[model samples]
Target: MKLIVGNKNYSSWSLRAWLALSLTGTSFEEELLPLDTPEFYERIKLLSPAGRVPVLIDGDLAVWDTLAIIEYLAERFPDAGLWPADPHARAHARSICAEFHSGFPDLRGQFPMNLRREPAPHPKGATADRDTARVREIWTTCRSRAGDGGPFLFGAFSAADCFYAPVVTRFLTYCLDMSETERAYAEAVMAHPLMQAWCADAAKETAVVDADEV
Candidate 1:
């Protein structure tokens, strides 16, 4: 299996699929392409239907889209327990992941993911406040309901957590004000072994995209 990703420092969707694959203990070759580069477009277009990163190529099957790649990995490695065991919890987890995939544009545009940057104050009227509030609501609800098993959103680092992991990075990058619950969840995500590994790699990367430098 091979996974094609974008710059570790800026590609949030790539991080999602990479994290999910790592958590599942899957061994796959990684192809890192610098975003917005001619090389990136040329390379990824050969593999992905949407010309996007985080495309998974297993044997002859190519899966694009972060959530779809995650689902494929989960089904391929059921022992990884990417989703919850309980039917209800699994359903709720899927719902949250879908919500994350479809919504949160406000948060995404205002606070792009940059793993090496320190948190800063939020800019006024920049969607930070509303985005932070919505994220806090989701975190509080998930932790209150399904966080008994562990520190993660669904307790055991399920696909839902993978979907939201980039949001955690964004919160830290922009220094978005978060509640106690949200803060704790962010800490847990940052401290996860796979996340730590990803951050380390991102920090070592020398290629920088000017657009994502902010």
Candidate 2:
């Protein structure tokens, strides 16, 4: 499999797809594109239907969207347990992932992910405040459901956590305040081996996305 992603310094969608694939323990080649360039458009147009990053190519098949890529990988590697084992828990995971996929515009617009940067003040007014509150609410609710299995949103790492991984970076990058539970969850995600690897790679990259820079 070959996964085409944007620079590790930015591109939240790329982070989601990359993390999901990394957790699967499957070997795949990675192609990094410097975002916001004509070359990016040319490369993505040739690789993905939507002209986006994080396109996963498995033999002759190409999956573009982050959610679609994860679903395909989950089905292909069932032993990875990309989703929860229980049907009910799996349903809950999917619901939250969908909500995250479509919603949280305020928070997203206010705080883009920049992994190597220190947090700085970027006032986003009432909308972002409310969105931040919603993020806390979601984290609290998920943490409450987390049993002794692991520190992830669900007991074990799943597609839901993969979907929200960028939000974790957003919170950290923006230095937004979160509750103790939320902080702990964020810490767990950051501490994951794959996440650490991603961060290390991000630190080594020289490419910059001006819009996402802090």
Candidate 3:
């Protein structure tokens, strides 16, 4: 598997796909493409017509889009349990992933993940606050589902957790308010070995996206 991504410090979508691959315990090659570069459009054109980062190349097959890549991997590696074991839990996880994937443009625009940066004041506004609240509500509900066995949503660090990994990073980066449970959950996600590796790589990246530099 060759996972193509963008600047680790700036690309939230890339991070999601990367995390899903990591969870499979499969060793794969990585291609880091700096965002907004001439080389990107030219190089990605052959890999994915969408010209997007987070494209997974598996031999002759190429999967684009973060969610699609994850789904493909899950089907390819069913034993890895990319999703939950229970059908209900799995459905909930997928629903949450969908929500995270497409429903919070405002929060996403306001809180770009910057792993290299420490917590700081976030922008304030109605949309921002509403997004934050919705995220917290989702976290609360998911944690309730996790019960006590695991710290991740639906437990066991499934695709749902992968989908939200960037959100956790964003919360910490912006120093956004989180409840005790929410903070614990976020901290747990950060402490995961794979997440630590991602953050370490992100720290080593010198590239910057000006628009994401808030």
Candidate 4:
């Protein structure tokens, strides 16, 4: 299996799929394409019609979109524990992942993921403030429901964590105000071995996407 991604510091979707694939404990090749470059376009055009990063290539099949790639990985590695085992918990996880996939435009637009950027709080507009509040609510609710399962959203490091992993980085990167529970969850995500590895790579990246430097 192979996973194609974008610049680690700026590509939140790429981070999501990368984390999911890495957790499977499967040996896979990684290809990083610098975003917004002609080379990225040239190479990605040959890989997927979506012309996006985080495309998973498994033999003859290629899965585009982060959520789709995650689903593929879960099915491909059943024992990886990508989703919560309980049916109800699994559905809740999927619901939030879907919300994350389709929602949060203001927060996303205002606070693009930039791991290399120094941590500082950015002034939030009304929309962004509302979005951030929603994020905090989601995290608090998830953790409350977790009931000592573990530090992650679902008690274990599942796809829901992967979906929100980038958001965790965003919250910490912007120094957004978070409650104790939210802060704890964010810390646990940052402490994950794979997340640390990804951040180390991000710190070493020389490529700069000016648009994402918010």
Q: Top lDDT: which candidate number?
A: 4
Q: lDDT by residue for model 2 over 18-130, one digit each (tens)? A: 98998899899999988999989988898877998889999999998888999999999999999999898888888888888888888887788888887776777798898
Which regions of candidate 2 are displaced past 4 Å? none
Quick one: how many clashes does candidate 4 have? 0
TM-score to native of every candidate shown: 0.95, 0.96, 0.97, 0.99
Clashing pairs in 1: none
Error of 4 at 103 (Å): 0.8
Superposed on all Cα atoms, model 4 deviates from the true structure by an RMSD in Å of: 0.7
Each candidate's lDDT (Cα)? 0.86, 0.88, 0.89, 0.94
- In order of listing, the candidates' clash counts read 0, 0, 0, 0
lDDT of 4 by residue, 1-214 (tens): 9999999989999999999999999999999999999999999999999999989999999999998999999998999999999999999999999998999999999999999888988988999998999889989999999998899999999999999999998898889999999999999999999999999999999998999987
| Model with the higher TM-score, candidate 1 or 2 | 2
**Candidates ranked, most accurate by TM-score first:** 4, 3, 2, 1
- Candidate with top TM-score is 4
Q: TM-score of model 1 relative to the true fold? A: 0.95
Candidate 1 per-residue lDDT over residues 30-122, each given as its tens digit: 999999889988888788779988899999999999889988998999999999998988998999888888987777776788877777865
Of 2 and 3, which scores higher on TM-score? 3
